[model samples]
Each structure stands twice: as structure tokens, then as C-alpha cells.
Target: MKKTYLLLTALIVFSYTAIAQAVPAAAKMNQFIDQLMQKMTLDEKIGQLNLLTPGGGIPTGAVVSTDVEAKIKNGQVGGLFGVIGAEKVLQAQRLAVEKSRLHIPLIFGSDVIHGHKTTFPIPLGLACSWDTILIKQTARAAAEEATADGLSWAFSPMVDICRDPRWGRIAEGAGEDPFLGSAIAAAMVRGYQSNNLRQDNTVMACVKHFALYGAAEGGRDYNTVDMSRIRMYNDYLPPYKAAIDAGAGSVMSSFNVIDDIPATGNRWLLTDLLRNQWNFNGFVVSDYTSVNEMEAHGLGNLQQVSALALKAGLDMDMVGEGFLTTLKKSLQEGKITMRDINNACRRVLEAKYKLGLFENPYRNVSTERAATTILSPDKLALSRKAAAKACVLLKNDKTILPLQHTGTIALVGPLADSRRNMLGTWSVSGDWHHAVTLKEGMENVAGQQVKIVYAKGANISDDSLFNKKVNVFGPEIEMGPATSDVMIQEAVAAALQADVVVAALGEAADMSGESSSRADIGLPESPQRLLTALVHTG
Candidate 1:
């Protein structure tokens, strides 16, 4: 017993010695960034403050610049987004590391919001699960796929808390409740960033739409938001605070204004609330061209807003060129201090350093790994399970659920057969061809015992203009050559034949995402008509 005790004491002593001698992660990171920043020129410093998307995913506007490659080589571009595939990312990274004067590495980011290659349930759907661990696992799977594809950052975990269903962006957030939103936010941060940003398989998590974006007036997207400090602190702000507490590596400012000031240039919101009050150490990035849009907000011109954003604690300007073109001019005119520029630059560089970009520019990224990791069987299985769990059974009359393995069933609706819309919104990297439709899933599950009848009962909508708008990213909602009356008849015939009618009906995929808000949010006219016909056929 005495010998055992002595050995345990020795083990404890050794563990203490090891821990005490080791440099703290924070201290080590600070040291590395300090040395790196000391050698950087002012131009390179400002360059790090820019985040550009090189035209691949959903284009918010026309590609404004032509010389992206030249910009990277000249140290005017710090990161690239909307560029996927390992070979493509490698080509871009080579220019940054080999051709640039300082040979600094470039961080690659993407909007892997819900999932990367293996699409999961949408954020709102996932929220219904009320399973934080499951949500975290989804983010981890997304990170694995994204990092394999040569990305180190993901613009995700959009924790905006919105009660209004009319606001389309609510699809991208946890619904309505600040407490639930906060839990999901922390889980996502833990999943993406994983306790260590230096890990190869981990991507930095971004907590987004900071400071009451969800309360846009009249549920309009990118509209003004106004609230008392009491409501802001108690209800709207908790999720963002929770994400920060969970160690999110960055924040993205919302497009709307708070307290009559645009979030991109609001010093009180960005500085006092985020930095001083909450003590968030990570950098803040603008939402797509939000800096330039401040002119429309009646804030100022490009130069004025650019300087305003910088002074307000914005570290990265996304797709605006406001900072790239005007920050220098503002500096010369004494409109903005050199210290503000340096501080923003340092924050940007610090994020890269934390990501261990200096240690290995192409960390966890390779053509071989990229090919092997995405859409993996494990990821798909998780997604399937997540989808199943996310479905909240609101009611089941006469124990109707847990359907028999052997039965005649009718799957009728626009969504039941929709391959493109199954992945839902913001799954930009997901290939719809690979998605399993309800018909496919039903048949695969029930096998030969179950006879499944399927029909596109109706178009997602009768409105051609709305269909065109939704189909901007893809043909998620397309009108067939057949008339809507013919489609409804076909669906009614299928329903009459089946023992059980499973009518899947909902809005088109694009009906609930960025800039897709509806004044009257409901099922489209055609699909609703189809449901009515199916009921009459019964």
C-alpha cells in the first residue's frame, strides 16, 4: 500500500511538471502572431482585412473583379471563398504562398451552413430535434468534408433568433427561442472549431448576423431593426453571446441596422457590445457588400462607411472593395487612424495564426483526401438519422405512424419527388443528384412488401415570377409541360388506389432563405389545391 501510494504521488508530480512547463495555447498563439505581424508591410496588413468569393456558389451580385489571381499574388487578397475542390484551391493557394512577397498562406472559407457535401436537415429543422449533441455532430461532419476540400473556415452557425415566420432567413437559424438558439450556437462552435483551431480536420466556426438582425421591421430581409436595450440583452442578444462564450473564432455583422445605425458601422454595437461588453477576441466580417450598402442606408458614401466600419471594429470587408479602395485614402485624409487599421489587420492575421496556416498552408487538404472524405457513407447515415429525428410528430390519429412494412402507400406532392429541393436552402455544396427523394426512400425502406404509388400532384407554385426567383440558385421549383389540372388528376387517381395517402407539401426550397421573405407565408396555391383534391378523392 505504501509503495502504491508513492508511485501515485510520483505520477501526479510528473503530470503537474508537464502541465506547468508547457506553454499555454493562448500565449503561444500571441507570440507567433506578434512576430509574424512585425514583419508585415502596411499593404499586406490591409490585404488581410479582405475576404473575397471567386464566383462559384450563389452569386449575390455580378462578379465585380477580374484579377483575383493577381490580387492574391500581390498580397491584396487574404482569403478565397466560393472556390471548392482540392485542385482548384491548391492552384489559388500556390499563388498566395509562392508568388506573394511575404509568402503568407491564404485561408479558404465557404458557406457550409447546414452541411458540406453530405447535406443534413436545415438549421430550423435541426433545431426542432432539440438535440445539441446531434447538431454538433452535424457540424463536425461538415467540417470534415470542408477541410478535406481545402477549406479552413465555414460561415455557419447563424444563430439569429426570430419569432416571425414571414422572415425567410429564419430557415437558417434556430426558431424563436433565445435559450434554445444559444444551446445550438454553442454546440455548433464546439463542433466546428473543436477545442483547437490548429486541428487539421476542424474549421473555424463563425457566429453570424450579430445584434438583433432577426427582428427586422415587418419581417423584411436586410431591413431596419429597432429594440430597447432591455429586449436586446434579454432576448435577442443571448445566442450571439452564447456563441462567443463557446469560443467561436469569428463573427459576421448583419445587414440591418440597430438603434438607427447600420450594424456594419455601428461602433456601439460592434465595439461596446461585442468587444468591450462581451470580450470577443476574434475578428468581425461584414455580410456580403454590407459596407457599400450603407450608402442606401443613408449612412455615407463608400469611403465614409469603410472608415466607419473599421473604427467600429470590423476586421474583414467581404466583397465590397470599400476597404480595399478607400481605407488608404481615409488614412491619408486623417479620417481614420493608422492604429485602427493596424488593429483590424492584427485581428485578421491572428485568426490565420490560430488556424495554424503558417504551420502548413494546405493542412488536411489534398486531392486524394478530398475525393475520399466528402459524401462519405458515415456522413450520409448521420444525415438520414438527423432528418428522421428532426421530424416532430405533431399528431398521429389512431397510431397511424410506425407504418406497416407491407402496405400500399401513395406519396403525392411537389416535394415528395423533388430531388433538388430535398437538401433545402444553403446546402450549396450538396449535389441534388445524390439526394434521396421520398419515393426512393420509401421504396428502399419498405422493399417488395410495400407497393408505393408516387405522383407530382401539383406544381410548387402557379406564380411564374416566384418560380423564377426560387430557381435562381437551381431548378428547385420548375413548372412541368403538363397543366396543373392534369397533375392534380394524376395525384387524385394515385390517392384513390393507395391504402394510405402521404401528402408531402410545403414551400419551395428558396421560399425561406436570404431575400426570399414573403408577405403572406403559406403553402402555394397549386399545392394547396392538390391537397384539397386528394381529400375529396378520399
Candidate 2:
């Protein structure tokens, strides 16, 4: 037994050393970045900061962009976010490495929020279950599906400790406790990266909305945030720091302004704290267009804000070519140093190297493997299990749930049949048609003894403004014209005859995330009205 254990230890040490040889020395990696930068023009370098999403994997806002190929070939784009599927990712990736002049490989990213192909429960609900292992497993499965879809990074494990339920984006985080949030943050990092990111089926994890997007004043996303450093360290910084400690390779800055400065321009937070204090060796990327939004935060023009961000240690600017457009000019003007540009570029290149992209650019974009692995039954089974576990039994009055598969069940609401919303927020590349809605779950799980009666009780969301904002990603929530009176009459009639009534309720697709804040987060009027009607009838 002792000889066997000694032999295993030797084998493991040899394996780690072999893997270590693949990485260029820190100094050599910097030299490689330097040589590459010397050969590249400013526009080409700047193009790397622009992350665009073309609709395919998971939807972001109301719509996905249509011209991804042109942008990649023209060198106008740096990376892609909403695209997935191995073949699609492969096609997009080939455009960057082969078609473009720089031949730089594009990093494919996605929300991969819960289970990638297997729709896990939303993050907030998952956190409520207080199971860290389950959460990590969720991230592991997400990495597997995402890599299978040819993505290299995930914008996930949004770790901001939000105490206010009024904050709709809170549904995307660990919720209300920094201690718990920090622990979950570390677990997710471990899950996404595993012990070796260079290996197959692992994707880089981006600890996001860095600092405190969740602390949006009045619970509004992108609203200003002000808190003392002591408070930040004691309460909020832990999760971001925990993610860093756990080896998350990248961090995305939030849209919210911290103190008096927009996060994108906060030199103290990004430089002194993130790099110096935490000693985080990875790159920092901005949230969607956050660099441009600095203008809204009262910061100056694009050039000035972009310079400030680079000096402050921001490495990548997502969807905003602020750095690419202004950095060289700033370098000439002495506002920023070549060292700063070198550092940022080095960070980005190191990320690519750590992902093993140089060795095999198509490592994750395997078409044959994707066919065999993308939506396998095992993955689907995991999704169904995760969905079942994430369902919070908020109110199971009289033990009304664990609902025996026995009687007529009224499965109602826009989400009941929602093919798209099932993936939920940030699951940009996830396939909605693949998700099993409550209606489908009923058909699959409800036994032969049960009869299912369904209705489109109401739309997912009824607010015009909310619809406009959310519809930017895909389908706007359209209200049901089955009038409140008629829907109520129908619902009441069905409930009266049925053995049980199952009412599903929640936010419309667009009620959370960037620019999706809602001051009144109560159930939308349609469902609220429908619930009221059902109660009055009873």
C-alpha cells in the first residue's frame, strides 16, 4: 500500500510538471506579447477589446446582432458572446484566426448561468438551497456544455451580496450574505476552471459585475453605489476576491458608479485594490459597453475615460472600443504608458495561453464531439434534476405540493410554454426549445392518474416599457387579450372543476440585468390580476 501510494504521488508530480512546461515563463510570455504588439497597429489591438454578440446561444437584451461574420473578418470585433453550438463557434472562430490579418483567436463567451444545455435553476433560487456542492456541480456541468459549444469563457457566478429583494437582478446572485456569497463564489470558480483549465471541457470563469453592481442605490441596476472601503472589504469585496483566490482567470467590471467614479474609471478599485492588494494576475474586462457609459457617469469623452481605465488596470473593454481607439493616442500624449498597454495585452494573451488556444485553436470547437455530447440524455437528465431541485417551495399551503400526480392541474402563465425564457437571463447561447417548461414537466412527471388542464392565464409581463427593454433580446412579452374577465371566468371555471390549481408567476424576461431595473418588482399586473381573480372566484 505504501509503495502504491508513493508511485501515485510520483505520477501526479510528473503530470503537473509536464503541464507546467506548456506555459511560457512569465517573462517570456511578456516578451511574446511585446513582439506581437510591435508588429500590430493600434486599430488591430483595439479591435480585441470589442466583444459583440450575434444571436444564437442565449439571448441578451431584446435582440441579437446579425452581422458577426463581417465584424470578425473586418477586424472590427475582438470576441463574441451570444454565439454557441460547436459548428457555429467553429465557423466564427475560423473567421478571426484565418480571415483577419492579426490572426488572433477570438474568445467565445456566454452567460452559462446555471447548467449550460441543462437548464439549472436560476442562481438566486439555487443559493437559497444552501448547497455549495450542488452549486459547483452546476458550474461544472455548465463548463462542459459551454466548451462543447466551443465557448472559452463564462460571465457567471455574479457574486454581489444583494440584500434587497426589490433589486430584480438580485435573482442572479447568491443573495444577502457576504460570508455565504464568498464561499459560493470560490466554489463556482473551482467548478468552472476545475484544477486545470488547459484540459478539455473547461472554460475560463469571469467573476462579474465587479465591485458592486448589485448594490445599485434603491435596488436599481446601474444606479450609483457609495460605500466605504471598510464596508466594501467587510461586506462586498470578499466574493470578487474569493473568486480571484479560487483562480478565476478574468473579471468584468460592473456598470454602477462606485463612490463618485464610474467603475470603469475607478483607478483606486481597479489598480490599488484589485492588482496591488489582491495581487490578481488575471485580466479585467468591462461589462457590456460600460466604458462608454462612463459619459453618463459624468466622466469626460471616450478617449479620457479609456485612458483612465487602462491606467487603472482594466485589460479589456467589452463592446466598447474605448481602449483600442484611444490608447495609442494616449500613449503618444503621455497620458498612459506603453507599459500599461503591454500589461493589458499580456494579460489577454496569457488568458489565451492558459486556455491552451495556441496549441490547438480548435480544442473546444470539435464538431464530431459536439454531435455526440452537446445535448446528450445525461445532460438533459441533469437539467431536469437541477430544475426540480431549484424549485423553491415558497408556499405549499396544506402540503399542497409534492403534488400527487393525481388530479387535473391548471398549468397557466406565459412562461408555462415559454421556449425562450426557460434559459432565463444571461443564458445567451442556450437553446430555449430544449428547455422543459412547467407544461412539459407536467406531461413527463405527472402520472397517468393525473389530468392536466392548462391556460395562458396572462402574459409574462404587461408593462410597455419593460417589454420594450426586454424585447431587445428576442420576443417581447405580449399580454394575453383573453381579457381579465374572460381569463378569470375561464380560470375559475377550470379550478372549480379541477382537483388542484397550479399557478406559476415571476418576472418577464427583461425585468433584470443591465438597463432592466424595475422600481416595482411585484408580480406583473397580468398575473397579479389573474391571481386576484382566482382568489375572488374561490
Candidate 3:
């Protein structure tokens, strides 16, 4: 194992060496950046500080930027998120590269959290396997598919440490152990970046939710996090540091505040600690509209918060356009210096340079490759194997676990045959139609000898309000017209006819991701009702 780890490290180093040989060295890169900055206007520099989303993935606000193409042409848009497809990405890239004055290539980024096309087990579940190599391989596959789809960056490797199950975003992180979480964080960074940011198969890894986001009081999403600096250093900060140490190219500021100030505008967290103390050289991006949301936190209005965030070492503003629209006025008013804007723009451009975007703006983006790479047979098979290994067996007495493949089995629950929920949360690019249902898997393995019965035991939740919340981003929990009692009866009938009953009951896919927190982190009432009926039927 030690030898394998050493070889992995050596290979990553070689990848980096190969990139250096192809691109300019540090001194030369600096000189090139200096020359580029001299040619850029004030508006163009501030544009590089702005990051926008084009209404494809999760939307945090009502508007989805109708003028994105015009903004790109005017050199007012820096980069884009939530946009996929080689043709669509190529269209957007052309506006920046061909129509804009500087013709600076835009960096396309997305939340390729798990598998981009081939969905793997969730990060929390992947950590349960305790296989760092498997976790790294999953990340590598995600990066490949993302780059094939014309993305140069991934906002992934969420390393927040969370012990509270009530925290919805807990599904995205590697559980509560700082030691294990740090290890996973490093492995994910190494996998995503893979020692070559310029490589087509690799994408710049953004280690996210920086500075105690998981420590939100009461386990509420976007809630305040108050902790002593000692507690922060010892517990919550290690994973972020580990990711940075593993050469992550970007860091995302958490939405929650730290020590009475929001992380986006907190110099102590972003600059004094991350940059000065820990020596993280990567640029920092705000969570979606988090910089603008500071107004509600009583920090200031749009202009005040934008200047505060820029001065606090925030390099990229995601979705808010606070930096794009307000930074120029703030500069004229002397609230921020040209040096600060130049520094932020320089970092953003430097990331693009490292990504080889400056050399070949359309590096590795081919329609044919995009069509063949995503959801390939090999990737799908790996995902199935990963799913089997990640699931922990609670008990298996007398080795009765691996039942003979020739028996009648009943698979019961809302989740048993649901394709949409299979990919889990944050799998934005995963196609649910291709997911293998439990019933299909059972039938395939049984080889027509065993009869597999399936039933929708219950809806994800009986409460209408909860269903609305979970389905905000997508159809996470779909409710049918049948009554709960009818569904329970159907499930019990199936269970009675089978030799063994498998109840697949849990929260819906959206119930555990961002902005989907629950006060009671248990099976919903409908599932509990279904389980009780099944127990009585037996």
C-alpha cells in the first residue's frame, strides 16, 4: 500500500512536470500576466472578478441573467457555471474569445460533485468504504466526463466536517471525523487536479465551504457558525488546509459567518488565516450569491459588501454580479484600490493560464469525445461496484447474507425502483434514465430463475409542504394519487408472497443536499407506516 501511494505521488509529480515543460515557468508566467494586465481596462479587470450562472443547474434567485451573451461580448462577464454541453459551451466561449475586446477565454465551471455522467455513491457513502483509492478513482472519472463536456473547472470536493445528520449538506461531505475527512479531501484534490490543470482529462478542483460551514448552529442551512479560533483550527479547518496542501486550484467561502462576521468579508478567515498563516495560494470564490446576501446579514448593501469582500481577499463572486456592476464605482470612490482589482483579476487569469485556456481556448473540447466518454459501459460498471462496496452490512448471522440467487424476493419502497433518486444530490450531470433499478438488478442476477416483485411502499413524505421543499431543484420526491393506506397494503401484499423482503426506505435524494435541511432526521411518516404494515403482514 505504501509503495502504491508512493507511485501515485510520483505519477502526479510527473504530470505536473510535463505541464511545466509545456507551459511557461513561474517567472515567465508572471511576466506574461503583467503584460496582459497592462492591456486590460478597469471594466475588463472587474469583469474577470465576476462569475455568473446560466440557469441550468441549481438556481438561488429568480433571475437567470438574460443578458449573459451581451455581457460576455462587452467583456463584463468573467466565467460561467451551471452550463453544460460542448455546443452550448462553445457558443458561450465564442462570445468571450471572439466578440470581447481582450478576447480572454471564459472558464466554464459546474458542480461535478460525484460522477459527471456515471453516478457513483454519494461522498458520505463513499467515505464509508474507507478506500481512498476508490474515492480518488471516482473523482478522476468525474473530471474526465466534465472536461469532455467542455468544462475546465469543477466546484467539488466539499470537505466540510459535519456530525449533525439534520444538516442537509452533510450528504455532500465525508462525515464528521477530521482525520478521515482530511484524508478524503487530499485524495479528492489529487484526483480532480491529477497533477495537471492544463490536461484535458483534468479539471481545476475547488475545495469548498471554507471556514466552518458545517458547524452551523442548530444544523440549519446557511445559518451562523460561531466558534473560538482554537476550535476552528483544531477541528473544522484541517480539511480545507489538507485540500490546499494537495494543490487545489480554488477555494469557496462558506455562506455562514465565523466569529460574528461572514466568511466572504472576513479578512481573518480569508486572508489572515488562509493566505498568511496557512499559505493557500489559490483564489477564493463565494458560494452562490453569498456576497450579495451579506446585506440581509446586516453587513451592508450591495456596494459596501462587494468592496468588503474584495478587500478581504475574495477573488471571484458567483452569480451575484456584485463585483461586475459595483466594483468600478467603488474603485472610483476610493473604497478599493486598482491594485486590489488587478490582484483579483490576475489570480483569475492565472488560473485560466494554468488550465491551458490561454494557449488553446478550446482545449480537449470535442463533440465526438463528449458523446463517447460520458456514461460509458466501464464507468457504469465501476459505479455499480462502488455502490455495492459502499453499503455497510449491519449484521449477517450464520453467513445467511448471500442468499441463493434462485428465490422469490420482494423489493419494497419509494426508492427501490426510482431512477431519479438513484444519482443522489449534486449529481447535476447524471442522467437518471440510465440508472439500474433494484428490481432490474435483482432480475438480472437471478437469471429468470428467481421471481422479483417490486412495490412502491410509500411516498417519500406524506406532508405536502415537505414535498414542495425537496422538489425545489428537481423531482426529488414525487407523490402519487394513491392513499398511504393503499400503498402500505400493496407493499404488505407483495411482502407476504416473497421468501425474503427487502425494504429500501430512506430520505429522498433532495432531502439531504443543499437547502434541504430537516428537523427530524428520520424516516418520514409514510415510510414508517409502510414498514409497520410490512412487519404486521409477516
Candidate 4:
């Protein structure tokens, strides 16, 4: 017993020694950033706070930054998203380090939400599994693929806790349990960033839509979110705090109004709650044009709102150009202090330093690595395994699910043969061509012994306006030439011939992400009509 006690004391001492050893490394990093900041001019420092996206990937907002190349060369840009491919990233980094005056490196970022190239199930779907280890692995795989493509930052781990099914963005987050949501949030952060941001394969994780974004009024996108502080701390704020505690490298301010002030410009929320109360050391960035959108929220004009956001602890402005265009003038007018600008600039530069961009700007850029690493066999296999686990089995009447191998099966739905919606939403980098459809998967598993018939039971929706909205990124909902009645009859005909019928129906990929909120959370008219017909035929 004495010997055992001595050994336990030794272990505790060793742990303290290891922690003490890490303090010098932290001090050294601070010194380096301090030296770098001393050399930066006001304009150059403000440049570090602007994050832009070149026009290639999907733009979540109305404006994509113009003259991106010229801005990078002129030391007017800090980081960029939507710049895909290792080759392009190398070129962009070269422009920043070689052509710019300060020779500062640019950080590359992307919305690598679920999976990068090897697409996994959406976050909400993955949450159904309640397997935190599998969720972490998915995030790690996403980071590996993203970094191989020259991205150092991933704007993901959308940990907003939502109870409203009508909100389209609910699909982007874990469901409405704070304890489970907090666990998933920490797992994601650990997966993406791991224990080291300097590692080439790990990308920095950004916990997004901070505070109470998911509790938007009426389940609408970017709507007002007003909740009591008690409710916020008890029900809604746990996941965001959990992600921060897990060492998420950054946070994105939501577009909602919390307590009658825009989150981007709310000093109480961003400064007091995030930094003071919670001790979150990472920087804060605004959601897409959220700083500028505060003008529309009746806060102020572009300049006023930009100054307000800067003073409120928002370190970076994403795609708004509010910081780039108006910050210098705001500084001149004494509307915002140089210390505010300097503090924000230091945070942004500190993130770049942590990413090791200053030491090696091209650390993550390699065409060969990207080719070998993305969508590899192991990743695809993991994706398949995750998909299987994510599927929830609520009921199996008469043991219908374990379908006989030699029976005739009728698979009828718009989604059965649709590969476009397979990966779900926010998979900006996923290739739908590689996605296996439901019919193909069933055939592969059932083999030649089973006979299967498929039909596009109906269009996802008969509403033209809704379809148009869902198809913003691409053709998610394709309207076929056949009428609704004709399609329903065709599905009924297929069901009549088969011994068992399987109907695959749900929201299209875009129907539950970003701007795709629904007023009525029910099946669309077309799919509902088809399901009724199938029931009648039985």
C-alpha cells in the first residue's frame, strides 16, 4: 500500500511537470506574435481581419468578393475560402507571401461540414446514432481530406441546438439535447483540430452560429432570437460553451438578434459572455455578411455597424468588406480605437501563427497528397459504415425489414434513383457522381437472386417556387415531363406487381439546409399523393 501510494504521487508529479513544460512554448508563441504585430502597419493589420472567397464554390450570400487576386497582392486580404484544389491554394499563398509588402501568409478555409470528399451522413442524421467516437472519426476524416486539398481552416461543427423541425438549418446541427449536443461538439473539435494545430493533416475547427441562432423565431433563417438568460444558459448555450471548452480555434457570430441587439455588435454576448465569463481565447468571426447585415437590422450604416462589430469583439469580418473598406476611416474618426483594431488583428494573426502558416505557408498544399488522400477506399468504407449506423429503426411490422432474398421488391420514390440528394446539404466539396443511389445499393446487396423494380414515384414537390428555391446550388429537384397523376399511377402499378413495397421519401438535400425552411413540416403534395395511392393499391 505504501509503494502504490508513492507510484500514484509520482504520476501526479509527472503530469504537473508536463503542464509546466508547456508554458514556455505558449510564452514563445506570444513573443513571436508580438514581434510580428509590431512590424505591421495599420492597413496591413486591418487586412488580416478580412476573409474572402473566390468565385468557384457556392456562395451562401448575395455578394462574392470581386478582385480577389488584386486584393491578395495588395495586402488587402487575410484569408480565403472557396479556393479549392492544392494547386490554386499554392498560387494564392504565393501571391500573399511573395507579392505582398509584409510577406504574410494567407490561411485557406472551407465549409467542410460533414465529410470532405468521402461524404458522410449529415450531422443531424449522424446524431441519431449517438456514437460520439464515430462522429469524431468522421470529423478527423474530413480534416484529413480538407488539409490535403490545402485548407487549414474548416468552418464547421455547427453545434447550434434546435428544437424546431421547420428550420431548414436544423439538418446542419445535432438535435435538441444539450448533453448529447455538447458531447458531439467536443468530439468534433477534437477530431478536426486534434491536439495540435501545427499538424499538416489537422485543420482548425470553427464552432459556428454562436449564442442562440437555432432558436430563431418562427423557425425561419436569420430571424430574431429572443430568449431569457436563464433559458439560454440552461437549454441553448451549452453546446457553444462545450465547443469553446474543447479548444475550437474560432467562433462565428450568428445573424440573429439576441436580446434586441445583433450578435455581431452585441458587446454583452461576444465580449462579456464569450471571452470574460467563458474564457474562450480563440477569435470570433461574423457569419456571412452578418456584420453588414446589422445595417438592415437598423443598428447603423456600414461604417457604424462595422465599428460596432469590431468593438464588440468580432475579430474577423467574412465577405462583407465592412472591415476592409470602413475600418481605417472609423479609426480616423475616433469612432473606434486603434487598440480595438490592434486586438482584433492580433487574434487573426495569432490563428495563422498557430496554423504554422508563417513558418510554412504551403504546408497543406500538395496535388499528389490530395489525389491519394481524398475519397480513398478507407474513407468510403467508413462512410458506408457511418450511414448504416445512422439509420434509426423505429419499428419493423411482421419483420418486413429483413426482406426475403428471393422476393420481388418494389422501390418507388424520387429519392430511390436520385444521386444528387444522397450526400445531403452543405457538402460543397462532395461529388454526387460518385454517390451510389438507393437502387444501386440494394442491387449490390440483394444480388441476382432478388428481382427489384424502381420508379420515380413523384417529383419532390409540385410547388414551382419551392423547387426553384431548393435548386439554388444545383438541380436538386428535377421536374420530369410526366404529370403527378401519371407518376402516382406508375408507382401504384409497380407496387401491385411486387410482393413487398419500399417507399423512399424525404426532403430533398436542400429542403432542410440553410435557406430551405418549410412553413408546414409535412410531406410535399406530390409525395403525399403518391403514398396515399400506394396505400389504396395495397
Reference-based lDDT, each prediction: 0.88, 0.78, 0.88, 0.92
Highest-TM-score candidate: 4
Give the distance in Å from residue 245's predicted Cα in candidate 4 to where it truly belongs. Answer: 1.1
Best by lDDT: 4
Encode model 3's per-residue lDDT on 341-370: one tens digit a residue.
988999999999889998998985789998
Q: Where does model 3 exceed 4 Å of error? A: 1-24, 57-63
Q: Which stretches of candidate 1 lie over 4 Å from their true place?
A: 1-28, 59-64
Per-candidate clashes come to: 0, 17, 0, 0
Positional deviation of residue 37's Cα in model 2 after best superposition, in angstroms: 4.9
All candidates' TM-scores? 0.95, 0.88, 0.94, 0.98
Model 3, position 58: C-alpha lDDT score: 55
Residue 245 lDDT in candidate 4: 92
- TM-score, predicted candidate 4 vs. hidden true structure: 0.98
Model 3, poorest ten-residue lDDT window? 57-66
Tens-place lDDT per residue, model 4, 1-538, is: 9999999999999999988988887888899989988988888999999999877856488779999989998888989988988999999999999999889999898998899988999999999999999999999999999999999999999999998989988998998999999999999999999999999999999998887899998999888898898899999999999999999999999988888999999999999999999998889989999999999988889999999999999999999999999999999999999999989988988899899999899999999999899999999999999999999999998888788899799999999999999999999899999999999989999977899988898999988997898888889999999999999889999999999989999888888888778899899989999999998987
Q: Rank the candidates by TM-score, best first.
A: 4, 1, 3, 2
What is the lDDT, from 0 to 100, of the residue 70 in candidate 4? Answer: 93
Model 1 scores a TM of: 0.95
Instruction: Name the lDDT value of residue 178 in candidate 3.
Output: 93
